[model samples]
Target: MGTSWSLQAVAPPAGTGGGVQAALDRVVAQMSQWQAVSDLSRFNRAPPGEWHGIPAEFAEVVAAGIDIGTASGGAFSLAMGELSEAWGFGAAGPVDTLPDFMVPSDGGIDLDRDARRIRRSKGALLDLSGIAKGYGVDLAADWLLANGVRHFLIEVGGELRGEGIRPDGHPWWVDVEVPPSWAGAGWRIALHDLSIATSGDYRRGLAVDGQHYSHSFDPRTGRPIANGVRSVTVVHRRCMMADGWATALTVLGADAAIALADEKELAACVLANGREYVSRAWREMLG
Candidate 1:
């Protein structure tokens, strides 16, 4: 939520631009951890075991997060708020002593869909930074479509979702950044009503005592990932899924990540230790 958002839409109504911006703003207002009064912040501070009512959008994102977390076998977790804060990624800033290792409580979050309520058990901290941006992009795309725009590309903080063809009849194309530590040109992919999200360790990491700590925290180790994988990019029908999967796969490193991507038939590309690994689905997509 602390990042840039852009949208390119065709034939949008006169006032539709403001609507799209407002849609993204609403998502950030509801889910941003930087804001003290945000819905997610309040829910994080809410007493455990109490059902805290949340907006429908927030509830939906939480449900998706839980689903992905379970599917990744806890590789993707929303309950790393404390770890993030300890590592100076959160509002609390850096601390002299690192917090003790703590495994995320996978099933601690309970959501009541009918009531639009969420309750956390075992003091699990909730952090939605990983997936909220992608959801915001999806919402922006929906906003454009609902406003009579048939073709659009929406990107929030690098995660993107595109639908329909460009006005010139060309598919929406995006460049996958080549890691700074890697060689060769970045790949260009055509987006045909699909979404792509990439997670990388080269950016947004901290170094302490000559050791690099990535922004991605592995829930299993309660620490930032120090794996050989440099980046993971995933393409999916929904940006939210792609966003979450990219983070999960990055945490799993190159081999396990590609394995899971194949098992799920996901289109993913992994860059690790100066080499590139492409899944079968991704190869087909490239072709």
Candidate 2:
């Protein structure tokens, strides 16, 4: 419920161009293939014990997630599958919970790069909720570009990235959704060669036993982040960075998130408690 995306490429409008239609079909098929979260979800399941091989894409994404998690101080780990599932946030978990926070600290995952294997030492699940969608968006954009489409805007599951300028010579526009009650406040970003992602607890909330739980979980604590922030949006040159930052900031809450964005010079907008705090870099990018 966070965000969904669409792609508008300057090839001929759907029915008007046969070649464009075929290319679009190819891109759609690719998106579908990579978005599945089942066993096919490369980030969901750990490698079998004694199994040392993985698909190239799986290896790549895992490596990327590990890097991001480390960089974010373990704020964006892939080892959240078990906790998410236990709380019914997984393909098998319940969506009902009154408590928003869960205890942190769980088993560890041992990743072997040379052997191309991952071992969940004590059996924790891996969930790539923060970055997978952005990865998919980037993949779609790459597919379109490689297929000879120079100008396009791709949005998938609320994350977006733009390639080239539109025929109008303006950068693509993507709106950052603020809580509806926040009057007259919106953040719209212009992008030509960047990807933007927004994460929020406004939706996908679970209510149980007089408590409400957010969908965003903290890998360190193995529970939902109690950050009262409504939304966090990040814009970056890499779709993966934008995606992960949006998630990391959402988990970090508004104040700390803004400070971190400032320290890192990441373009960001944080909405919380009926107000918005925008990073200087993000404000500059808008102009």
Candidate 3:
């Protein structure tokens, strides 16, 4: 929610740009943690023991987060709002120079999709920063398509989704940027009918007492991730899935991330310890 967005498209209907912006705005209104009155913020502040109803869009994102967290073996956790705040990356904004980090005893959120309701354990707080931007991209893309734009590439933050072809009759090709700290070459891929997301901390790494910390945190330890992984990129039909998988794989590190990516047949790339690990599906996708 602190970043920007852009769209490249063929001739679209009048006001298509404004339409896309409006769509993205809807996502922020429903999910921005920085906004104290957003649906996500309200959910984070909800009292325990009661099911709180959320907007459909917010519920959809939460459902996706739960699915990803479970599939990644807890590598991608949404119930870390408090931890994120403690790490100075949340809505609370740099709490007195990072308080003694508290690992919540109950880091669990129960979601009932049928009724679009959720309840979290006392110490658990749900945060969707990992996947919300990609959802925003998908929402904007959908809005464009519904309004008669057949070819476009939409990006929010760095996550992107593409549909059809450019006015030049070429697929939307994007060159993935390598983390500046990594020497590995990045991949350039066609984004036609697909979405791509990358997670990395080279630009956001924190240093405290001579120890470097990655912005990616491990919910299990309630601290910044110490995994050697420096970056992870994922491609999927849905930007939300791509975004969530990128975060999950980054937290899982190289070996486990590659194994899971292969098992799931996900298109993923991981950079760790000065080496690049590319999943089998990633090669096939580019080929």
Candidate 4:
């Protein structure tokens, strides 16, 4: 939510930037962990055993997160805000060690789709950093399209979506982010009605006593990832899915993630231990 965005639309309407900002403001108002008054923050601060009402958009994101978490075998979780906070990766500021006064870990979460509400069984903190930005990107793109701005590329906080070709008839071409350890030319691909999201350890991390830890936490263990995974990149029609998959695949590491990608027929690439693992679908996409 604390990032920059840009849009390149073919003959975009006037005040396109204003429309994009308004759309993103909706996402922030609903999901920003940094904003204590946000729906997500209020849900986090809520006591156990009470249903909290939220907007349809929040419900949608949560539903998708649950689906991805279940499919990833718990590699991705939405109720990990507390863990992130304990590890100094949250809005509550940094802490070197886990607090002793921690509340009972929740039994995960419950959602009432028809009611547009969610509940915490015990005490769970919900965080949507992994996927909310991509969802924001989607919302902005939808706004552009609704305003008759077709053939546009929208990027918000690194998550990206592109549709149609540029005015010059060139597709929206993007280079996959290369990890620091990678050698040789970076991979380039065209985003034609597709979105790309990347999750990585090298970009931002935590340092403790001279040992480094990835900002990405494995919710299963409530700890930062130590797996030799460097990064994961996923391309999908929905940036939300791509973002969530990138996080889940990063947690799953290269081998297992690749297997899952192939099984799910997902386009993804995992860079780990100085080696690259590309899914069969990714190879096909690149080709």
Best candidate according to lDDT: 4
Q: Total clashes, candidate 4?
A: 0
lDDT of each: 0.85, 0.69, 0.86, 0.87
Give TM-scores for every candidate, taking all chains together and pairing residue i with residue i. Answer: 0.94, 0.82, 0.96, 0.95
Candidate 3 local lDDT, residue 242: 98
Writing each residue's lDDT as its tens digit, candidate 3 over 183-209 gives: 767888899999999999785755667
Give the lDDT of residue 227 in candidate 2.
Answer: 71
Looking at model 3, how many pairs of residues clash? 0
lDDT by residue for model 1 over 15-67, one digit each (tens)?
88788889988997899889898988888888888899899999999999988
Candidate with top TM-score is: 3
Off by over 4 Å in 1: 94-107
lDDT pick, better of 2 and 4: 4
| Residue pairs clashing, model 2 | 3-157, 3-158, 4-158, 5-155, 81-125, 82-125, 88-93, 88-94, 103-221, 104-221
The C-alpha stretches of model 4 lying farther than 4 A from their native spots are 96-105
- Pairs in clash, predicted candidate 1: none
Q: Candidate 4's C-alpha lDDT?
A: 0.87
| Candidate 2 clash figure, as a count | 10
By lDDT, the candidates rank as: 4, 3, 1, 2
lDDT of candidate 2 vs native?
0.69
Q: Which stretches of candidate 2 lie over 4 Å from their true place?
A: 1-5, 12-51, 97-101
